[model samples]
Target chain A: MADTESLLTTPLDSLHRSLGARMVPFAGYAMPVQYPAGILAEHLHTRAQAGLFDVSHMGQAEILGDGAAAALERVTPADVQGLKPGRQRYGLLTTEAGGIFDDFMVANLGDRLFLVANASRKAEDFALIAAALPAGVTLQPLPDRALLALQGPGAAAALGGLAPALTALSFMGVAAAEIAGVPVLASRSGYTGEDGWEISCPAEQAETLAKTLLAQPGVAPAGLGARDSLRLEAGLCLYGSDIDETTSPVEAALIWTLGKRRRMAWDFPGAERVREELANGPQRLRVGLKPEGRQPARGHTPIHAPGGAQIGEITSGGFGPSLGGPMAMGYVAREHAADGTALELLVRGKPLPARVAPMPFIPHRYAR
Target chain B: MSELRFTKDHEWVRADGDAATIGITDHAQNALGDVVFVELPEVGREVTAGEAIAVVESVKAASDVYAPIAGTITEVNSALTEDPGLINREPTGEGWFFKIEPKDPAEIAALLDDAAYAAFVESLA
Candidate 1:
């Protein structure tokens, strides 16, 4: 067993402490969960403007060798070979039984494949990927780099003034550039479902770059509190909470993430199971749920059917700052997966009225 | 002031035989920080000593406040439904959580006093 304390650290630890951030252990690293501004204020701030998030704990790595793409393909159910240079794709990694290990983003850089996995699951993902790789392939973990996400509608314009090259970069595109003269790997991607950029830079220089970006207009420092709510508004899944090894991509409602090319031969681990689900659909499906009122239906809240029959349970939930209402994402019987089907969440043993709805509760603001 | 009582989970109570008003200490709320949602206990529900009575959610985490002593809930702070931040502002006053009818008053004496709670909170820091 690996000691989580030996996991990783970002350069901005002192800066986060200085800002009175409520530091919490996340993904093996001590990270800021929220600031003194609080999660609600930070959440609303990001929705109205831009929020600077220190996601440096996220794992960044590079796959080296001629079989880099093919090696990655053996573990993940994504067509990495077809990915053009500078383009990134959201994909799922699964176990031998078709259970998802993690969901991550992979980018082709013409030479090496850029891999970014969740911080908490990075070590496991690396081992899984390495175990499945062919001989002569090299997996270099770039834990030395830090990743930051500047999200919201104001993000694009803020980057436009600092990194003009980003102005031409469309959504899902990456560019090796510099922000305010600091070398950075900037990508137009985010989990907040907003127009933003994920910047990868040297771990030692992150604090300086973060401070520089924070100095920009309309950019406020956000914490993990807002990060969760913002991603909930966007209908994104939290790796450990919403999706885990026990849950399959289809059951988690992430079927679209599996590229058709990769699904054909089902070479990836758990391919047979994933293919079965794709063909006949999973017994239960994850769906978006909007409560009838301001009260939220959180994780572990049991989902009940028409006559109060237990159907499923909520996985992730929160009050969406942008949507102005309560939203949740959970899995229930496939029979109850319709957009207008009525459901209930058993909160504190009392059922709270809920309705199945489409995701992206507040809509996405990508620079498409 | 009424005789103050405490719980191991950090809830404070002022009992008058049957009716006991409960609230978290100022140190507890400060340690938790910026409470966003509070799942309050419902009236007329019977709760046992040391059992979870309410859930308080901060931005990043969720914690439960348990019953200090066995009792039946008589009233809950309805105001917390719309303004959960009151716990951050006045945890001992307007933020008072609930009132319970304790089945046993002797349990109240077993709790810590204000001075002891102060020491416990300091140890955590």
Candidate 2:
């Protein structure tokens, strides 16, 4: 942990404190980890209702000019040039070695491409994107904007009351809208695998916007604690934990993000490894793990085969509040990655029973 | 009659003669938030003061529950294995982790009493 004095504060810092949030240092910012309601209640609430998360620490930027999309394709594998206006697509910034540098969301906003990168990697991501961009295109960081995610089964309903036009936006749809007369850009997408929206507004209006959203019925404030559990249950890869510079898209089971045209062109960074992996599967693959007991197998727990041979390591593991049991995700040998393959998780010097299970420990209720 | 004492680590001991019942304090449980599992020390196991004898896990992370005084474990809380939430519901009562036969009953005198512990918790805030 860094010094508390050196940590940055989000636009909603005082709002979180006012709501009794337990703030902790995350990605250099003092962010809320949980509130008075605790992680369990917050996790369950997000599943049953709506959770408003202040994700301002994440990096927001815009790539402008006619060839912006094409320029972005130089470093990423997503079909950014084909993204329709008012639509967003998940993208992975690949290293020259075909490993994931960072995972981000790129939204096509007609004249420009808007990107949301993980906070921890935002600085490096923006620099890499800028350096890769062609002469005409330019990267513009949005330092004065704040991002908030409203996620859950009831997200649309809660947010719909404020901006009814948001309800008409399909999944991954982005649009300029107004909530309580505040100008904002909202997308019908979230990381929680729920029907929801991620709204970006001016930093000054963040507190007011968050308060307004929380005022909605069945909408409550959740912190990073709930956010993490929800994403894990949704089987989403966390940037630093699940996928990193050492992990390739294929090994992370994110081949779907690789566009067909990009694969054929082999123009993106690390295209050779990705191409080779596509032709012949990667040596190890990421898989979901379901422990047989209540004890969770936290991150870095060694994974072993039935015969005691170490197969891989757990990247993200914890008690899935929605699953009401322990759930985890890790990389394993291709042969042991099959669903229902029995495995052992070495926890506290003892081998705990676990198995490879299909991810999304619970069903995703996305409004596709 | 049992006399209650508290450790700076937030564990409480109810001393009845040479027998001592131990559990985490309500403040500790509140900070932990929603206990999901507990790993108790084995019965008859000898432990020294300040040694981590058990583990208590919440949804977010796991923490060690230290032994506040030297003693031999006499009994373990088996019920907690089935209902770990008991720690959140009754942290000092039915949520007791274990009982021990104290190696030195005089150690209880050095532990904080109710008022002193209350002040200690206040200072932390």
Candidate 3:
């Protein structure tokens, strides 16, 4: 609820306003929360067709110098050292205690490593990463760039005409290509579980590229409201809400991000503790929840056993528009993390029946 | 049409002798945005004016719907149970939350009239 006067504006600011988007301050930027179509319609539209998003607020940077990937490995547990060129990997920056500081995507652009971190945590993540860099490596923030995501089932068909090379790219693949005469680094990856692409380009060319994408058939402009719901249904973690400095990667069900080589070396930050947890398992685990009714049990709702023992708490909860029911994700005791286990959510002091369900509540449709 | 009255919380009530029907105003539904679920009080339940009597859930958040006047619940709208979007479509007609038997029919005049409610909504902007 801070004053909009102090907020930063992205390259698509005027375009968003002209399209009747409801602008809200997010991560210090005046961003659109929803358009005139509303959140529900925007959400369902993205699942069935295609949705365009202006993600220019996210931080873009490059890791340069000799042994850049090896230097990054000091702070993150991902296999940055062995990452193939033109490939992208999802990773986490961990605290000394093995707690995740931020989640990021790193694309090996052949010559330099292209890194993208969360909007709010970019500053902190960069500072931590910079301090951990060895003598030859340097992190340069890309302040002159902009980011956008084109997502859904119809996204490929809409964009494939401009760049035929895009059709060959697999999920998590990255390539530097020219789309409609604009040079861009298009990564076949997105926060939503749908098959999609996130394009990084110069700030000056952002509005032009976005306009071109929106003109494509079946592609409509979507905002952060639909983006949040889409990612939640995909069971993707929102940095501050779902995972934070107090939650370790293992506890948050992100062990898949730790490469086999990284685990064997056990030399990254908080490696001792992370290795111990990897072998023995964490005391608590993050799991998906399906509330047994139409009523949504929102974040901070307490989870209780049948007789009423506080076991865990809901971190992210809302109505999944595509599924036509309320869904939630939370952390509970490992023993209670099994799918189909009975649980209850305390909503307005009333116990609402819920069950532990498998995630990506709607199965991911990402390209293999 | 029965005489309509409004509450400060944006609920509107139409009172016809002892029976009254209640629902959130058009302004209320527009502000809430895309209602997905509605939970109303049980029929025959007694309620006081200004008490939280029902819940309206939207894609953005859940809001409590307060009773406009003291009454005993009579009938609830069953159409909203399957499709809550009616609140966004026809908030004053098909979207009526529930009906009740007023404890005192005279209380209806004390609430805001149509003109007064329009002025109140304008003042908020």
- Leading candidate by TM-score: 2
TM-score of each: 0.89, 0.98, 0.96
For model 2, name the residue pairs that clash: none
- TM-score between candidate 2 and the true structure: 0.98
lDDT of each: 0.86, 0.93, 0.91
Better of 2 and 3 by TM-score: 2
Q: What TM-score does structure 3 among the candidates reach?
A: 0.96
lDDT of 3 by residue, B41-124 (tens): 999999998899899999878999998888899999989999899999999999999988988877777999999999999998
* DockQ in order: 0.34, 0.78, 0.67
Candidate 2, which segments miss by more than 4 Å at Cα? none
Poorest stretch of ten by lDDT in candidate 1 chain A:
A1-10
- lDDT by residue for model 2 (A163-259), tens: 8888899999999999987899999999888889999999999988998999999999999999999999999999999999999999999999999
RMSD of 2: 1.3
Q: What TM-score would chain A of each candidate receive against the reference chain A?
A: 0.96, 0.99, 0.99
Best by DockQ: 2
Interface RMSD of each: 2.6, 0.8, 0.8
> Which structure is stronger by DockQ: 2 or 3?
2
